[model samples]
Target: MTNTHQRPLRILLAKLGMDTHTVGITIIAHALREAGMEVIFTGLKQTPEMVAAAAIQEDVDVVGISTLSAGHTRNLPKLARLLREAGAGDKLLLAGGVIPEEDRPLLEEAGVDRTFTMGSDTRDIVAYLNEWWAQQLAADA
Candidate 1:
């Protein structure tokens, strides 16, 4: 398990593609930091390759991408594929912002670890990451 007592988990937070909404993601980054995790915020308009590259460069345990353009159905899968091809598939992929409820399963099938809709508390995101990171460490061990 994660030496829950050791170093803070590192996370990369980004706004992928043409989406420019940063309010939600900014709050999430602050929340993760408050929850004792290290967060790297990659500003807006990031391509899948850029997102994957940031994840690799930061060596984060998780990557959270925020999108509000209704492109999750199309964009997320492509991002997942790129991450896999780039050898970053082991990193957790998370999506948030304006995601339709009906699209959750499809996004999951496309390799998104979790999807957060509007109104979700930041604490929930942080808690989920903590739990997820712990589980990942346990699995690696």
Candidate 2:
């Protein structure tokens, strides 16, 4: 379901690498859509290049990645670098799903604007995007 808004925030959701976790990303995508944001979900097994390309092509405001595999250590940084290299460093880079608490700092350092774990609520995610997008709009003004 798509929502009509003056300027609906656009987010792209991607499932990276061998991480086959679908339920979480699916639920999150639905939540974002329900919150009145436009979302483009890239199906599973996407490489960093693919994710970056999709985001650029879609002209999204945010890129949400979900990775459950241990490959996150390598994948996250590469994804960040690619996005940044493409001049998308200002775009909100969000990550979620099965990431360890210990690695949260590393992920943040690697360019993730926010990280959501298992117990996180859908409202929180929406609220964050709302605030971020609002700030961006203000800045652009």
* Top candidate, metric lDDT: 2
lDDT, candidate 2, 1-141, per-residue tens: 122234889999998887998998899989999999998999989999999999999888899998777788889899999999999887789988888999989989989888898778999999999988887777665
CA error at residue 104 for candidate 1, angstroms: 1.3
Q: Summarize candidate 1's per-residue lDDT along 29-76 as a digit string, tens digits.
A: 888888998989888888888888888888887888898989789888
Worst 10 residues of 2 by lDDT: 1-10
The residue-level lDDT of candidate 1 at 26 comes to 81
Predicted candidate 1: what Cα RMSD to the true structure?
2.2
Candidate 2 error regions (>4 Å): 1-5
| Cα lDDT, all candidates | 0.84, 0.87
Candidate 2, residue 92: Cα displacement in angstroms equals 0.5
| Residue 89 miss distance in model 2 (angstroms) | 0.9
Q: In model 1, what lDDT does residue 58 have?
A: 81
TM-score, model 2 to reference = 0.93
